[model samples]
Target: MLDLRVFENRELAQRILMAITREAEMIGREVRLMHVCGTHEDTVTRSGIRSLLPENIKIVSGPGCPVCITPVEDIVKMQEIMRKAREEGEEIILTTFGDMYKIPTPRGSFSDLKGEGYDIRIVYSIYDTYKLARENPDKLVVHFSPGFETTTAPAAGMLEAVAAEGMENFKIYSVHRLTPPAVEALVKQGTNFDGLIDPGHVSTIIGVKGWEYITTEYGVPQVIAGFEPVDFLMGVLLLLRMIRKGETRIENEYTRAVRYEGNLKAQELIGRFFEVRDAKWRALGVIPTSGLELREEWKELDIRNIYRVGVPKLPDLEKGCLCGAVLRGLALPTDCKLFGKECTPRHPVGPCMVSYEGTCSIFYKYGALF
Candidate 1:
């Protein structure tokens, strides 16, 4: 068990950093490790932990922010779903995370629709969405849910709740993604990351064994870790050790929250309500079975299947904005010309800037530390 006190100890933290630095020297080469969790990036940036790192160590952020990676086509599809429902005289309520509300689509943002008298509500959790459904039984409740295993598990559980309650008014347009397929896609593309600092939240839901494919097939090492600076440093050290050992395998450094089998109930709910499908990421494009769609039996509970919502032709993104590249770890936030100039947190020109978990947003807030 990873005690919380150990992580909070400044002296212990210093020792971990010292050992990590020495290990970096021992490896004696440039090391690229990608962490595909926005929360992990936030911890690294906010804690000024990157400044304590050795020179040759680089930690890159991958497709971690759910809102930043959602394809423009899906956003357009969301727009169409709400509009068509209103056109057909159906009262509808669209609920999603606030990040999704501000994310720019080809047409505009969901916030734009909100301004035009659309009934789009920003919800903090699926339970809040359920409450909305129960209260407005006459109105069709559309939940536009998106995230990795962490968020997906809850969405799955919500579906189970709906089925148990015999509720037919609620429907979901799931843009949920699985990280393994995205990671594998990275390997297939010959991405240069030598190892992975996997997301701890996702691992807690999917378990450590879910990542076996990374080492077994892609021949890459992965270490799951929590949000603390020590956990992340430990994960990096594990990766370097794997490199020195000339071995590729998946290991867990976040055992305090994660286990080998994960949350079996959450996994059961997910397996019951969802199936794997090809999902289009912003820059990485369509990854094979990387997305979760409602199961065939749950087709009636799926808005896309019920309404036949088609993808709309999206408008071109802002010229010279590299949010796509930034999400894929190919380019840093500073690489974009408009990052701090034309695009800031107040007025974001791209989706990456809109998401608090986004690399651009993190860089904009704390790039000076790096």
Candidate 2:
């Protein structure tokens, strides 16, 4: 096992900080870097990395949090499934990650519906959801699956398992998304980012090579970094060096876990069970080929295919919420007027405030570190 403490060394962090300061001075211009991982945001905020950085080096949060960026339309569809089930006097259980349970919609949240005797469940993994289906053979088990590559692979594995066993009780409502396309959307839409910090967890599944297209086509530099303070700081330093040298390529700082080719088995599993599709995000509209849906062969196990829940058309974010801008890296969480006041983790007005991985929630919890 890797000594996790080595990655958190204070001495190394200070050295990198000094190097980052020097690089910022050498560059002699403002640099904006965006990272698309919730854990990266937590590391940046909780470790006080932002406060320690030179004023010219700014880190922007991207649509890293799956729960935060999950379109409200998908949530409404899940609710619609429950509502329709209730109307027909059917007992169906809705399962999702804990982070996804409290995401608010116009019709309230899964937690709210759970309070009102809806069969909503918080599960840590797809296996737990599968277990629910096995335990209650009579009830329909619907998993509201939403995530990037890291979580999606396991869902595929479970689906394969379900198919092999001929299990019909469990179904998945796949809102799984792809990280590369969203990054492409940000680049294509002309988001002002100098460099990209590829997410460590997602890269572990997709591999470092998966993000090469961003640099190959857009001439943008990227670095895959872990969630540790040193890992992030090293990624920033690598990006700064690339930026200064006018180099456009990907560097792997989290090589201990991530690789150039990534986990082939996981990638194959994902491809086996899912197909690329255009999907909606909370703030960013429909990004082309940015989402995953179950393959036609496995459509029987898909919840969206099985249920005809009428999803009402709804706006991405609530009125006056800047989550859309935040996700696009156009604004900061603090820039929102309601960030600390009206929109909080306790009572989120927008999707960004609801999840711990959300930028607003991280800033609210650890902004005091600054």
Candidate 3:
């Protein structure tokens, strides 16, 4: 078992924060570090770390929430696929994590679609879909696979399993996005940030080598960080020191799990079952080679082909919603005209307020929507 005492106590966190604040003051320059993990955003807000930081240091939330970035068009397409199956008198089940149920689309949401007589089931994992496929051979089980590298390895493993067992009724709606390309896009957009606090879980899969481009090409310092408060503060301090010295490099603070080369077996599995393709994010549109598509050998399991469904286009968000700007880091959640007035977490007008890890939701929960 992992050592709980080291990270459970708050003393280590306090010490790290003190060091970071001291280093920030010595630099005599504003240090802005962006964290690309939603969980880290929650940790920072929940622990009140922002209030503790020096005035010269700023921590901004990046486009890290998977649910927030899921394009509305994709959700609408999945809903349409379910509707088409029902009209043809075929039994179809759409399974996904419970967090994805409330993510809104242009028309409505999966919850709304389920309320309109669609079979949308919530399963814990892809293996559960295989079990459901075995129980009901007559029904088609399409799992909505949405996540970063942390969750893609298991989905890749499940695909290999389904292929070995020759399960024709089971398939996955692939909406998986990679981390490196998204970071590259953020940098190319010329976001005025000094450094990046890289995603630790994703780094465990893709490794530190994948982030070399950010430092070499984009000239931004990045540090892979863990979820704990001490780990995060240390990462911040490292980035600040690097910026102070005018150095840009890829550093890994979470050395226990992440390595230079990462997990090759997982990478091989992903390459075997899927190929890189262009995908649309709700806020950031059509990033090149950011998404994964199923391989041609597994075309038989493609839900779009099996059900003969057409992908539909969705309209842009209603006016006065700054979710797009917030995701792009051009604006904060409080900058929205309807942030706390019309777009509370209870009645979110966009995906940003729907997910718990979303920046707007985080701010709303901690009363930071000033």
Candidate 4:
């Protein structure tokens, strides 16, 4: 375990809050800050950090939760693909992380499909899927991979390993995305947030320098941050400092883990197996080059290509489901009419309620403050 002592001290936290309060007061305007990671949302909310922020300073959730942002149409498309494979007399096993298994779609969840004996398996990581593929060579193993750059790296690495070893039976259905393009979309759409409290896990993979364009183009400051309560407070303080000075640049509050160039080895692995393509965001729609796809050289390993299924068309949002607004930072979890009434963590109607790191789930657990 990490012995990061200063971060845990209540006195230090109080002092940081004071500094943030001072900064917010000096600015004397509504300071809109967006934290673009689900883990960060959990930290800010679960720790009651949002409740502690100055009334004038609002911290909002962004396009962070991977599962929450996974378009319902994509989930539906995967369900159809798995069903089709079964109908075609192919013994197939669909593997994905646990968070994805319960994300509802028009066709219900993969869990529902599993209950019907469709062979949906929840694996911890891509490597585990690889092992499963190896053990059951008789069945077609389709790994349903999803997440941001950090999770994408390992999935890509596994695909590379499959290519090297010629694992013909293994394929990947990639829902992995890059964070930069999403940030750009928010800026282009005029989010008007004072600064970004960036995700540390994503920054650890893509590095601090990857966010340079957001500052250069949008004049918005971003502070890379860790998952701890103290890390979040420090990130906000750094942002406040930037906003007060009328500066727009990338700052690294998560210095202990994030580096200038990020994890090059992971980048290399990602580059080797995947390429940037125009991919869909559930709420944001298609942001050009925001999503990752298998390279042409490895197209045979793409589940879409192998199954002759095109990119799923985006569907209309469920009636009264404010998940779209929530993901875009346009609204809060409590703002949705269905939040606590029709939707809860136990019986989630939307993807946002299903994932542990999702804003709706976080808010449901911690209650909304802003």
Query: Against the hidden reference, what TM-scores do the models get?
Result: 0.96, 0.98, 0.95, 0.96
- What are the clashing pairs of model 4? none
lDDT of 4 at 233: 95
Stretches off by above 4 angstroms in model 4 are 310-316, 368-370
Candidate 4 lDDT by residue in tens digits, 1-370: 6689777678999999999999999999998899889999888887888789899989888889888788777777788787778778886789998989998876688899899888898988989999998998887899888999989988878887898899889998889999989989988987768899889999999998888888888888989999988999999999999999988888898889999999999999999888998988887788988988888888899888866644445553668988888888889988899999899988887778889878899889876442
- Let me know the TM-score candidate 2 reaches against the reference structure: 0.98
The per-prediction CA RMSD against the true structure, in angstroms, equals 1.5, 1.1, 1.7, 1.7
Superior by TM-score: candidate 3 or candidate 4 = 4
Candidate lDDT (C-alpha), each: 0.87, 0.91, 0.84, 0.86
Segments of candidate 1 deviating more than 4 angstroms: 1-3
Worst 10 residues of 2 by lDDT: 303-312
Could you tally the backbone clashes for each prediction? 0, 0, 0, 0
In candidate 2, how many Å is residue 87 off? 2.5
**lDDT tens per residue, model 2, 1-370:** 7789988999999999999999999999999999999899999999988889999999998899999888888888888888888888887899998889999888788898899899888999999999999999899999999999999999999998999989989999999999999999999999999999999999999998899999999989999999989999999999999999888899999989998899999999999999999998888999999999999998999877776867778877788999989898898889999988988888899888888888888889986873
Superposed Cα deviation of residue 57, candidate 3 (Å): 0.9
lDDT value, residue 208 of candidate 3:
92
